[model samples]
Target: MDVEALNALMRSEFSQVANDFIVQSVAPMEAVVRMPVAEEHLRPGGTISGPTMFALADVSMYLVVLAMIGPVTLAVTTNCSIDFMRKPTAGVDLIASARIHKLGRSLAVGDVLIHSEGMDAPVARASLTYAIPPRST
Candidate 1:
């Protein structure tokens, strides 16, 4: 799948929050995604919320999978586990780098690292498993 095509799919299919996440680059089994942190993404401590970071990781891996397997809307997150690391820097963007380790006929597994822009250490890491849709007759 193509990067531009993947982005367009995001725009058309997920217009609700599509603009929030950008598909920076996508390759065979990897993708870089970015989210321009807004006030809505911040929490009581004025830092990025855990849910926001998790969303970044989720979408990052989802886009990577889509880049590899096409826009399979039926593909769903069957399982996900995320670890919140250091607190993210305030007032900048968040980036997620995801790499897919396995892509089988029924499942896909990948990991994502989230970084607060300008920070050296990762803010969060996530492991995601998705269930690919079976082909219909």
Candidate 2:
């Protein structure tokens, strides 16, 4: 699936948080997703929260996998290791660029770098592994 298709799927299957994420672009084994930061996504310190960034990284990888494998909703994240490099800009969008390094029949492993809207370096980086449900023959 491409950007539109991925966004549509998110709206249909995960309506509650659909508005938070937008599929920006998608290619063979990679995708970029943007999250428009809001008050709810910020912690008391006025910086984007870790959990929120984690969610962004997770969904970005999910979209990347779906873009390559089609709308296989059962594909699920099995492991994730994320590093918070710095505090994000007060109020700006967060962009997650994910690339799938390994794609196998049942597992996909990738890394995501999340940047603060206009920042040169990433605010966080995550390495994730997802378990793709076995396809029906």
Cα lDDT of model 2 by residue, 22-129, tens digit = 999998899999999998999988899999999999999999999999999999999999999999996899999999999999999999999999999999999999
The local lDDT score (0 to 100) that residue 33 gets in candidate 1 is: 91
Whole-model Cα lDDT of every candidate shown, in order: 0.90, 0.96
Query: What lDDT would candidate 2 get against the real structure?
Result: 0.96
Q: Which stretches of candidate 1 lie over 4 Å from their true place?
A: none
The TM-score values for the models, in the order shown, are 0.96, 0.98
Clashes of each: 0, 0
Give the TM-score comparing model 2 with the true structure, all chains together.
0.98
Off by over 4 Å in 2: none
Tens digit of per-residue lDDT, candidate 1, span 1-137: 67788779888999999989998888779999999999999999889999899888888888898889888987889999999988898789998999999999999999999998888899899999999999777
